[model samples]
Target: MKRTIRLAASIAGLAGTIVLAGPPTTIINFDTYPDGSAVQPTDAFTTQYSTVGVEFNGPGPSGNSCSISPPNHAYAKRIVASFVDPCTGVASVTSYAGTAQDSCWVPGEGIDMFAYDRDGNQIGHEFNAGGGHFTAFSFPQPVIARLDMYCILQGIDNLAFIAPVPVLRGDLNCDGAVTSSDVGPFVLALIDPSGYAGAFPSCDIRHADMNCDRRVDGLDIQGYIDAIFPP
Candidate 1:
């Protein structure tokens, strides 16, 4: 239930001044995805980025490990990789320099890492040096897009991503702004949450419940309109 407030013209004029902020920026932790696989090799990643083709030429039965979640696409400011190297029980990370392999690796020694941008250009490279290694790199700018990664490591686990802050509530289209464009989706969600979710999988449905009543109804719709129109 919601309480109704009636005010004189002077006070009502300020009603439209009420503004609701967008959703809080949050991190997109890849750990949400299960382990033992490489982020399902998304087409979005494959189409946008070149799989740098990590190669391991060590004598000690070398291999690589990588895992990411949401299985198909990633919308994050940056991706984080965590790993443990069996050979040294440590991790090594470095910037990639267009070399066939990470220069960090010597003749039959250590691990090499290579990171690439969407244009198949080497952007960064790093290797783990020791226990519970973690490193992150940001995109050219803050964006919601997919970035593919490959690693020739011993163990990979708990991969996560970082989502920027403050989601714009009512911007169901996620176009960075709220307008009439959101009305259709908002109505659809108010009537059918599942259907709406299916249509906009990336949208946080909670943001639609503008009244904070935990329910989507006519009142919420009116509240959304008020937030948009404002006194």
Candidate 2:
């Protein structure tokens, strides 16, 4: 059964608004992959999983190397002799805010996990030092785009993450309301997307896709006007 957790306290301010509900949670347990299949390399796992909103990378001095163990579990192979310096595992999501996972480590081996935002800022981090058992690690915040895991000979399973919330249509300013105030930003999104993003770093320019054709062009102008000045 899927488990649901409470939203982080940081986003509590969005309550009583159209953004009250949190984004859906997704879990990748590695069981779907064929037994003992490779999990790294763009073609093997990254590309296939990106469609589901997550990307994986296992980088080492040699090359990327990770695989699925029997039954279910993502095992990172040790490319170096010392357990202290192990392979690095990276999982990236599209504007995700938080992530968690169940991990198993060898005796005296553990993992260090770090979360980064869209701008490459470190938003959260967690570390587990003990070993020989499963441990649940989590980093909940408001915006996370990447997760880096460092461990030696560890097994990772049940990776869970919260997807990014969809931006409200026509709410270019992300103020939870579509009003006249969005006019300038909407025009900016249609004309100069980069400028619009710079003007509102927390807002999604795609909100200006008033016609829902996947682009903010001249076709959306009438719809946007109608939203701001309803008849």
How do the residues 1-231 of candidate 2 rate in per-residue lDDT, one tens digit apiece? Answer: 122234544345555452454455455555553234444423233323333455566322112123222344444542111010001112223333322223443465555666666577776666645433333323444456666766655555545556443446788888999988888988888889999989999876767766655567998899888888888
lDDT of model 2 at position 125: 65
Off by over 4 Å in 2: 1-24, 29-105, 115-125, 128-146, 155-157, 174-176, 194-203, 209-231
Q: Ten residues in a row with the worst lDDT in model 1? A: 46-55
lDDT of 1 by residue, 32-133 (tens): 222223433332221111111121211111122222222222322233232211111122222211111222323332223445543456555555333334
Worst 10 residues of 2 by lDDT: 79-88
**lDDT (0 to 1) per candidate:** 0.40, 0.52
Q: How well does candidate 2 score on lDDT at residue 62?
A: 16
TM-score of candidate 1 against the unseen true structure: 0.34
**Residue 165 alpha-carbon offset, candidate 2, angstroms:** 3.4
**Clashing pairs counted in every model:** 28, 0
